[model samples]
Target: MAYRPAGLRTMDEAQDMPPQSPAPAGIGVRGWLRWAWRQLTSMRVALLLLMLLALAALPGAFIPQIPQDPAGVATLRADRPQLATWLERAGLLDIYAAPWFAAIYLLLFISLIGCILPRTKAHITALRAAPSRVPRRLTRFPVRDTHTTTATTEEVTRAVRRALGRRFRVAVTPEGISAERGYLRESGNIVFHLALVGVLVALGAAQMIAYRGQAVVVEGRTFANSLVDYDTFTPGSMVTGDDLDPFTFTLTELTSRFTVDAQARDFAARVVVTEPDGRRYEDTIRVNYPITAAGANIYLAGNGFAPHLTVRDAQGQVAFSQPVPFLPEDDFYTSRGVVKVPDVSPGLDQLGFTGYLLPTALAEEDGLRSVHPQPNAPLIVLDVYTGDLGLDQGIPQNVYQLDTDNMTQVMDGAEEVKVLLAPGEEVELPDGLGTISFESLPRFAAIDLRYDPTLPLLLISALAAMAGLSASLFAPRRRLWVKTTQDEAGHTLIEAAALARGDDPGLQRELERVMTAVRATTPTTPEDT
Candidate 1:
């Protein structure tokens, strides 16, 4: 009788077990509860979890992330409040960081571990066991061949052994020979499943230890890795302010060029960065090029011009004279911003202001428009206001925007509506609030930097998964048996057969070659000649 493994018998018994009595059905009942739990833990359920993980990652990559584009998200929410609220409740805004997405990935990893651990142990045990005995009915096997020979049974067995030794895992018996090969397939399957778990663990570690942030570098400004230096930041759960790197870099120069004749894609910037250790790294950072240093990568995401301006009171004393960063409203040359003069030498006068249109600014029938981003024509249209500029209040205000809520427009009539000021020109305030003078313009670039230490581990896990998959899919397990008996005339009668647990085309061909080689080497006997 053929021996069957204990695990196989247990599997068969479990499948053969009778079904239990049907339970009463209702909404939110015990029957549905039990069914849901059973489905969630099953292999089919785990496969569904894997599919869900793949689907959940799609939106994060396809959609503009709120973490990366907060301004865009704010605009979207403002335009569609109801839809944004629904998406937020469904965890669509931040799908990758959501609890439900994490749960799916975690469960998939658990299922992979559960399936691989026992199979790996079983494969190790099977590899150590002795080769199975040859069956008595060799002719009934899937592959069988016979040939009469004058050579002794031992001689025939030796010839067969030599041929089988070339490629297969073989063992000789007194009757004939038994051989087996291709256990690597099972080993590979286990490896692939284990690697998947490793990948998930690496991703989880990255999420728990990585940090992303953006820091502004003004011209000739030097900054260290500190919370105060960063404009926006997103830190991993385990990362604290003290964990930041102490390395610092100085912005030696920042320059940009705009295409006067071509499209917006022709714009570019060159930034010079000098490390604290006196190492100089000069790189021409473009739209696609990102600089990496000190465990962080910096991307040249955007840029705008900071115009140098000087504000003076009626007495000719300088009130506010510095480079004010003007945010570009659109990609065109039209930039909009405010200039506030709360403190003046003449007196405590409130001066609220709005920037005028630059030269090359396109004007439609209604208002001013920018034809191009380049400053080919230079002009500034000023809108001034005078009132109580609430700068002494505890509440913070944006420098790029003016709070006209507490101020009154001083120049609202046609004669004062649009005061055009050319380059190196000045506009005198009617109420002795201040005098505005345009100076030079300097460009500034926005950069986003990120640091993740678990990238190497993630790559290793990916390679392991590939290796495991190749092994499992190409390797196979097979067995070969040879049974020999002497006929009445004292001549040896040999019968050889082969079988495989799984189909192995390569092993089948190898077995056929061995049988043919053995037949050719064995001597044939004359019968009644």
Candidate 2:
């Protein structure tokens, strides 16, 4: 039993109603599917799907993805085998190409399209229609005012119609004068949603025709735009080996400058670019600037040190000698690398050396460390290993690592020899096995070439979306009405009201302005009217 107001019903009357009944069964399979479709196309579902898509892409930023950095992914697997295996199996390492991520964004795209088409149709119909009818009770509106004037009803009505017609969609109905404005607000909302759909479509299409790859080139070495020349390559489904660009570039020199704290301040790579027509041009590549040629971009990603070494066997015959690029370990460029001279003399053991190369060698408490990134004084400290290198077993091995699982440590008696060498210096092995020489020092450049035809379309669609958002945010929708009637003294009484489609604080000021104009401009006397 509920308490009642003056005009409310009693408890007995409320209890007199019949009891509610349950809904009938048998909505059918078709009806259930229809319900599911409606839910999928709803705005709430669309927003949820958009959020899910963003969440799915978060892992890509932290994880080493296979498509972008296969070498990094391989290194991750070697460093943390179990974690990398689980992430790879779950497709976290390839988030964009994952099925679940694709499902979320594809559903979001469909949902936006479904939500936009109906709103577009409604807006088009509203544009073709006339202004709404004047309300029966104008004073009941949120913003309404009444003004009694000596002017006649005809003069007041004519003046209201002419004045509002200047800025709004004016209409003079038999009931009263009605005007509405800001139809572009709804159109902007529709355009914004449609542009989102365009962006999604453009990105999806771009993935099918895009191709990107990375390569590492030592100074004085040239890299060609071919699949065999790249250290890592990721291409679209439609891209073939023969479709690679015929352009080539040679890394002639690389220069890097650093601050006192060992932080890199500048990196530049000088190269001679050759076109397919045999025309060559020399240029320098900076960190912010990338070279664009043959419909692709070449970016300078990293710079590292490569040391030239000469290895010889017992017969003094040269066995393995080349410039090996060392991976940087810290800001000061303390590098670590492994050298494998597999082809020693026959009936002899394979040679392997793993060590650290310091650019500016400084003696630390524990061992040698790097104090700066510059090549003021370079040093290489290594530990020699011999025996089986497992090269002929057909197992792929990283060039920067030597598998010492089946190898034996070579030593001078019981202690391993600390083989250290500077530029132009040479050292002989402990067992008279061979000699190693430290030759010239060169820098390597890491370059990435990427080609995507849909970049321009993506940029245009993104700009369009922003433009639509600006239009929607600034344009406000409003409805105004001017009602005129005769008062008890036979004088004309003019009333105006305003209602906005959404929250608009300016409606009150607008209503007051219209009322003031009607009062001042209306004919005072009937003859003057």
Candidate 1 — which residues are off by over 4 angstroms?
1-42, 48-111, 130-168, 174-181, 216-218, 254-292, 301-438, 474-510, 513-529
Candidate of highest lDDT: 2
Q: Go through the candidates in order and give the clash count of each.
A: 5, 0
TM-score of each predicted structure versus truth: 0.62, 0.79
Task: Report how far residue 1 has shifted in candidate 1, in Å.
Answer: 50
Q: Tens-digit lDDT track for model 2 on 1-529?
A: 8666876767898788788797887879999988988888898998899888888899989998877777678778878999999998888998878888788878999899889988899999998999898889887887888777887777777667666656688888878889998887878888888888888888887666889888889999999999989887888756888888799999999999899888889999999999888989998988979998788988998889989999998789899889988889899899988999888888888988999899999887898888999989999998998888988775546778989998988877878878999999999988888899999899899898888888888888899899889889988788999888776778776778899988998888877777767777644554322
Off by over 4 Å in 2: 1-40, 45-108, 148-168, 172-176, 182-184, 260-263, 364-366, 412-416, 469-475, 486-492, 513-529
Q: Which lDDT tens digits does candidate 1 get at residues 333-446?
A: 477767788777645566777875563665579977667776666667778777777777644455567888888887555556555666688877676665788787666666
What are the lDDT scores of the predictions, listed in order? 0.71, 0.86
